[model samples]
Target: MSDIAIWLVRDDALPLGQRLTAALGATLYQPWQTPGDSPREQFRRCFHQHRQWVLVMASGIAVRYLDGLPASKYSDPAVVVLDEAARFAIPLLSGHEGGANALAYQVARLTGATPAVTTATEALKPLTLGIGCRRGKPLHDIERAVLSALGTRGLAEVREVATIDLKADEAGLLAFCERHALPLRVISREDVAARGWTGQPSDWVQQNVGVAGVCEPCALIASPRGQLIVPKTAFDGVTVAIVEDRPQTAVRHEP
Candidate 1:
């Protein structure tokens, strides 16, 4: 049996729970499975038995259930809270020491949900790359485009790569991410259309992809509080934009 447990309170979320179970090789637990036990009892049992947990329910409910079960960051299970809508995957506990942040990113990649990781280590990362390219563009072209955009910066400062969902399975993009070991975050077309970005609109993108533009919008969406440091720069067949995360403001002392 896998060490990961996926828990859901509602019947409606069962489908998503099952999908996660299959993807993560996790065991699924629902209230209906054990009629004799209360929901809390079932959750408690799974909580102690599993090393990692994916909770498919409201954040409030997950918090209430997890109230006293946690021991410490060192020993507590990694807990990720996902909503029924599957819009966001948030790492609720054990963000670093227990791997909740990594689990959240994996869940995001699997379900196309945005990973809302709030850990300081991740939040402090400087840049996110937004890329768009023609289908079948080679890894070298994509790498060159990204490197050209980075100029003085190195890949180490990039937190992740952002792109439209259409390119989520693009071979070259996947290869580039794999080569650099960077997490790829994909934004849906619907999300791209809904979000406001300042990049020059592209007729090709609008007619073909049904979005205003790809690179800038995706970078802005991936790092919601970030600013585009490098606007859309085009190579032969690829476009790349770089967004820098807003730096934390230092508190000023009255002298």
Candidate 2:
């Protein structure tokens, strides 16, 4: 099921709701009645059911209804409130970890409204990953290797995935990126070679893929000014590297 739920009250709001659903890939929940359940009752049921909620009504209405469903920020789902005219998107609760702040910004972009984001942690962006694998390596192996590498450094999220162009159609890699909704950057072998490798030279990779190392090279090239934060680490047949892009100059990573 899609994690998003949108509630609309009036027919006039339907057009705006439809536009939001298309932009945000959300499911619409009209305040429909089922037997004795009224629209408000249905809204209450849906509020507890979904991971994220977008109520296209006055902010006051959302505040009044959500008063009873209160929980800790760690446990509550993201809640966003939008005006009927779509003029403003306010992250009513769980603005950071729950993703309401991001969702509000997304809704604002779709409807030309102002996104009022007040959460401090929302300012931090997700990390990007560059990876390489054996010809037929399974997805779980890649995932385990990457997760282990990230865990060592206390990093949690990935913004994008990068690999040599040769792996663009690699079934396991492609499926993994798609499943996680990560934008995949396919760097050409020539470009990766030009960037040069930061990791130890691998004669096997040099003979097979014409690169000194696939993971470190791809990661370095993907972030133009970034240096390797995590050097090429191998697990099973997969290799993972991490780079942190600085705003201006690159910083050296300790070996």
Candidate 3:
């Protein structure tokens, strides 16, 4: 089940609105339903009930309603503005903040429409990795882990790690390592799960066998997803992480 929903406003006779909805649903590969021919008040009431939905509005009238409604935590949804013709897809209000940018792309892919994705991070070819700490996740979780890992022999000389380096790309990591004079060795099973993550090493482990010669256990490993776990003993120092995706679903976990 998706925590997202789509709202389509259209003329009763035209199939453009419904077709666009179908296209977006097909591309997302997730179940999404449209509230057909409903009044604006009813739509607002529906949105108020569910907060995580991504509303795809296909009309100027709906957009007007969206503009007039004051921002409220319980009422405003991540709105995606689609022209009636679906000729162009525009992600206005909640672009990056509300997952609107991703929703826009899905709309484009489904309807062969162009998405007006203006976020610099998405526009730039960058890797986006998000490290998550379960148990009432706090920023301190990542901060403490990085601070703890910094003192390890391999990372002692490193200082000021970029939070964004964890983006879903390698260049970010490489750049962070280069900027800090320290080695950001990949956390291997030996380093991440000396006590557990056992079994024959995978191809990735074999390739990075000795990339840094500094084999120390990673204090913590984080991914975009919110999965996390601490392995017993020391590990190979190379750990795989997860990155952010369309729905902002960060599934960080221990392997």
Candidate 4:
């Protein structure tokens, strides 16, 4: 009877569903467990009773089941969809108003999946942190480098963390992003090499990582419409840079 419900149609998804249930403190509902009621009926009951939902199945199935149930953004429960592979956590409904976007991030943190947030509010967030570190660098070093780069800026302003795809699986970087609840954006090495960067290139990086630089170019690529506020700064063995998006001013129309 938790406020959150996790529904899975397949037995294969049960493990992930259980993990999500434990992490999110949600009730897991399965087909066989529905007493006398059909899975769809159970889904309907959960939909109305819960404040949030995690649907672990194909998006089409979730959509088919949810077709006529959504009442309003304000009243409808937030819904997050995850594939059986658990590679992506998507906020399928009520992204901004119903807290699905935040829930998706939480799921990603728990599963090491990527949170696919499509909301304008999340996209327009001002700051992006670009980070690079040695292989197997511990979380504390990465955290220190990022904090130093942030300086006076707070973590709330940060939209995402950007890193070269080579470092996408870096444990330290992942831990830092998870700790801060920041989505990690992985930029391809080719894209980073093709882009222009401001700071002096690193010889070691050129030879070892096959890139001229990691932090600044990653920040630039991740925030295409942004300006680099902090150049590449190193702490221990980790490098960190920050980018800030140019503010958009809305036009006021005179009637």
Candidate 5:
């Protein structure tokens, strides 16, 4: 489970905070209940303690508590703010890399509120995971290896999975992708080779798969504008690769 800390400062927000804790399986911290630490101190402690934080209070209060701790989006913890009424969830900081937008969407789904997601990538859901494994590899092993590799970069959600066309009908790969609710993309060998992957070369892979490595090339081909965030990492005959879609630059027309 991702490390999450849910904070509540008002009695009216208690039920919603508890619901989030139960639905999302997060740690709920009520500073009043603890009765020792100041609100700012509690916020600082929670910020350092968790990867994602949900503040169940006014947005201004949330902003004030986080006053001096803002870091770059990639390194900062995701922060979501919901009013005491829980009518809406807003991803206040670190919307994409820190996963605040996705967390807000999840909170809205559970609480019957609206999620105000402003991040372009989170709205598009363009990330994909590329995988390769030996025949009959266990689904659990593939899942574990992929999670382990992606967790290092703080990316847990993938919109889809890509692999060579030869593995399209592979039962283990299909099952693994299906279990995660991600679409499976089967890439042709020619498409994989065109990407010019720089991953580790293997004689056995070249002989069998017609490519240097399956995971790296497939990920690159599937997400053309993406950068390989995590390169091919192998465990127990399963290899996992991650690619994140790069933010597109806006083109201005000459007036």
Candidate 6:
């Protein structure tokens, strides 16, 4: 078995992600296709076969199955979804917090397909993960390290502008914050787009803030004018309509 495992739906033709799997040495588990298995029962069989690490599911079937499980049961395996063509790579389930994000980039680089990333912190550049997740939560050493890594010269300003539909396994970010005692500012999408970012952003979150969790303590909201920096990721997956951004209540302060 490979370091990462994928539960896939079997099909004809060279599936889009087969090359990626071969390259990554991912163990492909096709429980549904096993003989004597009932199509109706595939959900159960697939569920029983699930393990930790990264999982690349084929259709909404897996999404519904996993979502039905309680949130605590989410051991937070990095999850990515690939359409039948494999032309598009979508990190729907555990994108950033779970490590699905980096995995998506890997798949995108290998397949030459566009990664459909939709996190806020990643859209902007030089974001601070320590400040995004736990707003009031203090991050001590981790804050200092992030400031040093990003080389933020001026004072730090935070705002929670808007919220995106965020679902991540924030272990790395949470660790950084706890060590440093960093405080996050919450804002709105309209706020991010209304006002340009002031402080430095982290490299990871800069890739795609709204699609990527780079801005942890903040979400990246975009508009015709520019972008807004929200405090948290989006809630309620149904409404991509996004929220509005008001002036940042927090100013340049600790972290």
Per-residue alpha-carbon lDDT of model 3 for 91-164, expressed as tens digits? 66566666666666556545545566555544432222222122233333343444444333233322112221
Q: lDDT tens string, model 4, 1-255?
A: 898889999888899999999988999888876569878877876688888899998889999889899989999999999998988889999988998988887687667566788888787679988888889999888887787788898888899988887887799888888898777877777778888484979999999988899999988877777898999998888989999988558888899
lDDT (Cα, 0-100) at 89 in candidate 4? 88
lDDT of 2 by residue, 80-185 (tens): 9999987788999998778887688667646656566566553233355789899988878887888887875533356456788788768888778766655466
Question: If ranked by TM-score, best first, what sequence of candidates would result?
Answer: 1, 4, 5, 2, 6, 3
lDDT of 6 by residue, 113-192 (tens): 34555655433322323234333323343344344433343223321122222312234444543344332223333344
lDDT order of candidates, best first? 1, 4, 5, 2, 6, 3
Minimal lDDT window, size 10, model 4: 105-114
lDDT of 1: 0.90
Minimum summed lDDT over a 10-residue window in model 5 is located at: 152-161
Q: Pick the candidate with the highest lDDT.
A: 1
**Number of the candidate with higher TM-score, 2 or 3:** 2
lDDT of 6 at 95: 65
TM-score of 1: 0.84
lDDT of 1 by residue, 1-255 (tens): 688989999999988999999999999987887778789877887787888999998999999989889988999999999999998899999988888987888899889888998888776778999999999999999999999999999998988899999998899999998899777898888888999494688888889999889999999989877889999999998999999998659888899
RMSD of candidate 4 to the truth, in angstroms, is 6.4
Instruction: Please give the clash total of every predicted structure, in order.
Output: 0, 0, 31, 0, 0, 68
Give the TM-scores of the predictions, in the order they appear.
0.84, 0.49, 0.37, 0.62, 0.50, 0.43
Strongest candidate by TM-score: 1
| Candidate 2 lDDT (Cα, 0 to 1) | 0.76
For residues 1-255, what per-residue lDDT tens digits would candidate 5 score against the true structure? 449989988767788878889888899887887778797797786687788998998888888999999878988989999877767789999987788876776676566445666676544675678888988887888888888888855433576677887787688887886687555666667767777584787677789987888988888876778999888899889988889888678987899
Instruction: Return the clash pairs for model 2, or none.
Output: none
After superposition, the stretches of candidate 4 with alpha carbons farther than 4 Å from their true spots are 131-157, 162-231, 235-239, 243-255
lDDT computed for candidate 4: 0.85
